[model samples]
Target: MRTFFNIAAFAAGSQALITRGDSCCFHLTASGGASGSVGQLSDGQNRIGDNSLSPAEFCINSGAITDGNGRGCILTPPTTQLQCDEGATPTGGFSIDSSGKLEFQGSSKFIACETGQNGGLNIYTTESSALSNCKPIELMADSCAAPKPQPTSTSTSTAVATSASTASATATAPATPPANNGCPTTLTSGNFEFPHLIVPIDSSSPDTAAGTQFNGKVTSTVSSIFNFDIPQSDSGKTCSLVFLFPKQADLQTSSFTFSGDGKIDFAALSGIATKSTTFHNAPSVSKDLGTIAVSPGNQYVVSTFSCPAGQTVSYEMKNAGSTSLEFFEDFNPSP
Candidate 1:
């Protein structure tokens, strides 16, 4: 059937015609920039508006129609070709490539899917396979749900037996040895120092032999032993000293001994001595502090010693290794 109508007779912005069709197509044309060729189509109980102004443009506005069944329009692609904006070459916005990939052109173009409930949008492939085979790029907020844990059955007697076995095993285990009560684990460059030959004794009288005496000098009349210089107030308190060598020094195959006539003994010292490279411009000879030999290694040699109250002690290096020895004292004694 063919019908013709002059849209100028209708009021401006008015609904000019209404048609009911199951399978029909309408071609609209307008001239002189006229804007009154608006009409409505009835597809069953749904009313679809046809607001066409030019040959290349048409729009459907359903604001005047209401349906509780949530009806919508579907545009099926004929021969797998779909285009927007009169099939014009899109400078930006949405497009589908020949590979069937939906692409958004331009930097600011985006597609936003809004959901009103906790559910999120899901995308799947057209392949006929299990859902697990299709991996989705999840970008939704809090969309993943954790699987619930299943319960297992256990008997009271079995649980009690297992608890008893664990307790018995724990009780039969051997006790662990105590941790090493030693000097600080980390040593810095500042911890090294040139060995001091003599330090003033902590005494009331400078000439007192009791606390201000030194052993016989190794080369000179004046003893050249490395003095610890324990304060008179700190007498009788235990202390520790750590001897360290530079990285260039080898610690293996080196030996050191501490010997002096200050009533001190090697029973308080503990460390390994190792061979090391000779230091440049090192002193030709080093004095002795004690009589006992100490093994040398890369590790620091720790010595725990104490001087009797109102008495003084002197310490000297008897065996200077390949490298010059540097000594540091732990003024803060370990408990």
Candidate 2:
């Protein structure tokens, strides 16, 4: 039924060694001294390494085949089905069907490639386990593109004008100072509008008016607090006029105060009720400033403070309840 043999020595040059069994045969050959050798296993119509003549059931070759047909080693799975296993239980690592299609089995199944213009490629299954366990994939851009141009002055003038007009209407205060003994006799209000309202990008080119106008508005309902930056040129000057307007009636009962660099200047109410308050520059601890009240026609309260160069000052109107409030600032060279 079967026969086996072992040869320890063989002649050099070209030689053909063939062995036969009941259902399988093997062919091995060597040529040109000891340069290279090739071996093939086959069953009548099929060979192991070279599948050109028919189809190799199984074949193994180290170097390229020099046969007249120029064939190499090849392995073909069975026509029916094929399964891989570790030991007893079926692992199903990979399989080939009769049509020569390969399929993979398991939870995390994917194919990865390492060569591409951007990076690499990754393909994953759409199963629930893959979706829940895998991390998100990120996509990248191929190349950079130019940026969009900014708007010109001619196109944005209307919008800038409308915003500046609204801010001037709601934030502008009366020219006259409040009639209180505590208030300074002479004060100056700077012509500069709110800086926050102006757009800095327009200052350079194309749309220049944006830098010249104040077009910002800030409204608060819970607390009447506002902060603004004072330019370096006005550092030694004083903020002579800080005005507050109450949009709702409930704001009348609250008190307003201005503080800079962590020091409180003075506090005032909306009516004629006077209170002794401390001033940041006053030599005495407190002064009897008359109650801070809204002007009859102006409908706003005013306070004053010494401005620090290149620093932000804050004004707070507490106890506003649900009433909305508006605030404005004016810096004067003299006080």
Candidate 3:
């Protein structure tokens, strides 16, 4: 029942892409070389502009369906034209039902956008989302495949009153700086939160030191590591490095993490759910710096952002569900 996905008008006056308004579009099956839908530049080589119009916004990924820029439409190897690829893990990730019915990891295949092989309009899912020339693209045209919201700091929303648990206490104090209290740039919710000790990143990447903090988890993956500091009076004010999942469905990627040692389920299955972190490094594994997307009407999220205050903020963090990530720094506020 959600359908206005114009996706920022497919942008074409200057360039650069991503303008954003919670947009969505992905309709493609045209033949004149383009035009049924597609717009966040899906890497198949870019060509979407018969006047563009709209369409190209899908983001449900725990394995892949990505296209609001996270890419992944991949299911290739059969005809070879389907490849939007950014972090492609596809084989699963598309499911949609409450009676809306969309399937891909639910497996009868079905994504089909059509035209392929270089003739243009490419994208497919095979076994039929009704291919022939391809054109089955419907999820109400598009409005909910999410994934994009990780910056928090306009006073952190300023109204959380309660609900917390990393030893709970929910401390609050820092938020007076958009020129010393005129505030409202957005981040305020930091009734203060604490609980430390995290060391698991034995170098699959991020920086090269994991000799202590007691030396645990890094058995080969599920990365972790910690270090925090940022008080010069919070210098210019935007501080967020949060994580606390006791259940907003434990923020998802679910196999029941936190206790269920199933390897990497730190809540790992909602659109492939997130747990990627990397700050202060310099190379190409990418999370850019930190990635946080855990929502069940909000489960105290926000996993990265710092300001000019002082310094020392290292987090190597990895992915999967529940391995312990309760942090608060000039942070808090999300009941």
Candidate 4:
């Protein structure tokens, strides 16, 4: 029934004072204010539900309650005092009642969720969702659960689509061999400028040369040349050679063994070659550096290259195409 607000009551006007054995529960809501307060009540056994109590049993606070107007009419003794002081903030707290429902603070911040309290939380909506954004104040809880990882099986594959030119020599056709226009034809040994021309190993055989030959097939934009020739300089000076992959891709190879038959018959493969040049006339006096080689007719090998923007260069490599082989060498001049 109607519970009059008692200054000495448990939930203020929300519940009646326990007279030895008597007990009651109540729920509260702040319908009009920007923010509200709440409280909980319980005989520690039963719980209370919102508005379940008959209107007559409830009392309104004078300072906090109003008839929607300025000072219209403040209810009786208990109700008048139950009205919250003007601008008083609300902190909703709930407690269990004799039944099992929670009794909560009559003011607004719906923070409590026990019996006899306002269970008006829309868990998934803005108001309730706002709870997460609130600064977290710690209250020793049992434990925090570990976070779950995102599944990758269903994630999009990020394999980059690299170009073929990034691998083997793009073509066997010579691009007007590096300009020898200003190159001295008969300069003294050891005196030279760069953009140095590669000496082609001249031979009628397609695969036999003085040095080792690469045998794998290069699956790239470039093609292999039948003429294995790099014009030699004056000769007799030890030198080194380097090959670059103009772009980033892969060059697969089976092995690095070179056959003396003058061919490199590599297995399955992918190859990348950008700048591949042999150096001549260095100080290899009485020295012999074996040739670099790859194997497996079709095995792709890892390669790297970064070409400047605007200008393009072929980055490719060649392997024993089905059964192809290339030859190389380290030789001294004919004394």
Candidate whose lDDT is highest: 3
lDDT of 3 by residue, 31-140 (tens): 33234444434354322333343455565422235566666565455443445676664333343332333433232233334344443344454444344655434322
Candidate 2 ranges beyond 4 A from true positions:
1-191, 195-221, 244-296, 299-301, 320-335
Q: Which candidate is the best by TM-score?
A: 3
Across residues 1-335, which tens digit of lDDT does each residue of candidate 4 receive? Answer: 00000001011112211111111223333322111222222211111223333211222121111122222211112111122222232111112222322222111122222221453211110123323322111111111111112222231211111111112211111012221101010111121111111112222332333231232222221123211112232122111111222111222321222332121211111221122322221112121111113232221112111212222222212332232333221111101
Q: Rate the local accuracy (lDDT) of all candidates.
A: 0.20, 0.22, 0.32, 0.19
TM-score of decoy 4:
0.16
Cα error, candidate 3, residue 220 (Å)? 9.7
| Each prediction's number of clashing residue pairs | 24, 5, 33, 106
Residue 219's lDDT within candidate 3 is: 30
Each candidate's root-mean-square deviation in Å? 40.8, 39.5, 17.6, 37.6
Error at 111, model 1, angstroms: 70
Q: What C-alpha lDDT, on a 0 to 100 scale, does residue 210 get in candidate 3? A: 44
Worst 10 residues of 3 by lDDT: 1-10
Candidate 1 per-residue lDDT, tens place, 1-335, comes to 00000001111122111111111122222112121222222331111122321222222111011112223222112111112222222111121222222222101111212122222211211212222222222111111111111122321110000000000000000012211111121121111222222222212232422222222122111222332323344433333333332232432232223233212111221221111111221123322212211223322222333423333233433222222222222221111
Candidate 4, residue 41: lDDT: 24
Question: Judged by TM-score relative to the true structure, which candidate is superior, 2 or 4?
Answer: 2
The order by descending TM-score is 3, 2, 1, 4
TM-score of 2: 0.21
Error of 2 at 314 (Å): 1.7
Scored by lDDT, model 3 comes in at 0.32
Measured against the true structure, the TM-scores of the candidates, in listed sequence, are 0.20, 0.21, 0.26, 0.16
